[model samples]
Target: MTVMAKPRPTGQPGYSETLPRAAESAAVARRLVRTALAAWGLEDQIDDAVVVITELVSNAVDHGRLTSIRVVVSRPTEDWVRLAVVDRSMAVPLMRTDTNDDRIRGRGLLLVDRLTERWGTDRYRWGKQVWADLRCESAR
Candidate 1:
């Protein structure tokens, strides 16, 4: 992905960081999310946002093509913070309904579903971005 020296405006505060598509990159992604939320005064959403971003980054590292992925955090509204992972993959993340305790995988998106107000994928010419919106109750 091309790096932007300055972030484009989205009518609210936003930030993005490009990182290697590796497991360790999740830590950096978490810090990016936490920092953005803290700057926006949305600290209450930090824990859930971190979890959501970690899952998204994990999926990207496991399934996405290419060597790097981008993590984006944006406050589109006072009450909502958007966390997104962009990778060079067209694969849409499906939340498996057949997961059992015996199953070792396939429950990450389920956890994301439970924690976020809404989430989905945005496909672009180069790849896809999976994003989740966390609602801040205190912002209301």
Candidate 2:
């Protein structure tokens, strides 16, 4: 899906939203990324966090299509902001190291692993919650 950067007027600092994991989820994620950043007056930092969150939500839509996706944005005491995405998927995303093929679609987890400040998962009876923490310089 092609996503154009959205231009938004600056504003506040926190919001969390949940969206269903479906074919249109990418669009929802993109909108959320832009809205979250703009609402927090941190539109400038949207690229990194958006990119990361995009991948996370994309994975949810792609791998866990029948589940639900959740996103959270917080200033967390000012100095930085955190961007988190959670999905109801029982499959723990595993980073594949055996393949050297760049086109093979398993690179999402690796990319997420390298980009975020911190990332991990939480097990649930029906699924799991995958999350990442994003730090923004102007978040305060």
Candidate 3:
């Protein structure tokens, strides 16, 4: 995705990273989210946020043919934390419903939907960004 870097107002802290689009990147992404949340004193949100980010990263790696993927984590306001995953695929993420109960996969977006306050995708010239917003106040 063609994400433009915007300046964070005074004390807002954010973390952004680009990693190779490999299976291992999902774990790295989770760790990054965990560390960022801990640093921001939002550890209570870490578990859910990590799960959301892991799913996003996994989806990007599975669908996007790009060599690398970018992840952005930021607290846009005191009440909300945003996590975004960008990959070089123009296709947006869709929720899958056909998988049987025995299937071990096809439930990433479902989990995200249930956990996040809101989630959506933004299309860019280069690709697309899938993002989820978590309510910080509710998290606590």
lDDT per residue for candidate 1 within 1-140, as digits (tens), equals: 99778854542557899999999999999999989988877778888889999999999999999999999998787677889999999888999888656888778999999999899999999899999988887755
Q: Lowest lDDT 10-mer window, candidate 1?
A: 4-13
lDDT of 2 by residue, 1-140 (tens): 99997753332435767788775766677677788777666677778876777777777777774557787666664456566666666887777676667677768777777777777777888777777766665532
How displaced is residue 73 in candidate 1, in Å?
0.3
- Alpha carbon deviation, residue 55, candidate 3 (Å): 0.3
TM-score of each: 0.88, 0.73, 0.87
Please give the CA lDDT of all the candidate structures.
0.89, 0.70, 0.89
The local distance difference test score of model 1 is 0.89
Candidate 2, run of 10 with poorest lDDT = 7-16
Worst 10 residues of 3 by lDDT: 7-16
Q: What is the TM-score (0 to 1) of candidate 2?
A: 0.73
- Candidate 2: the clashing residue pairs are none
Deviation (Å) of 132 in candidate 2: 1.0
lDDT of 3: 0.89
Q: Which stretches of candidate 1 lie over 4 Å from their true place?
A: 1-12
The count of backbone overlaps in candidate 3 is 0
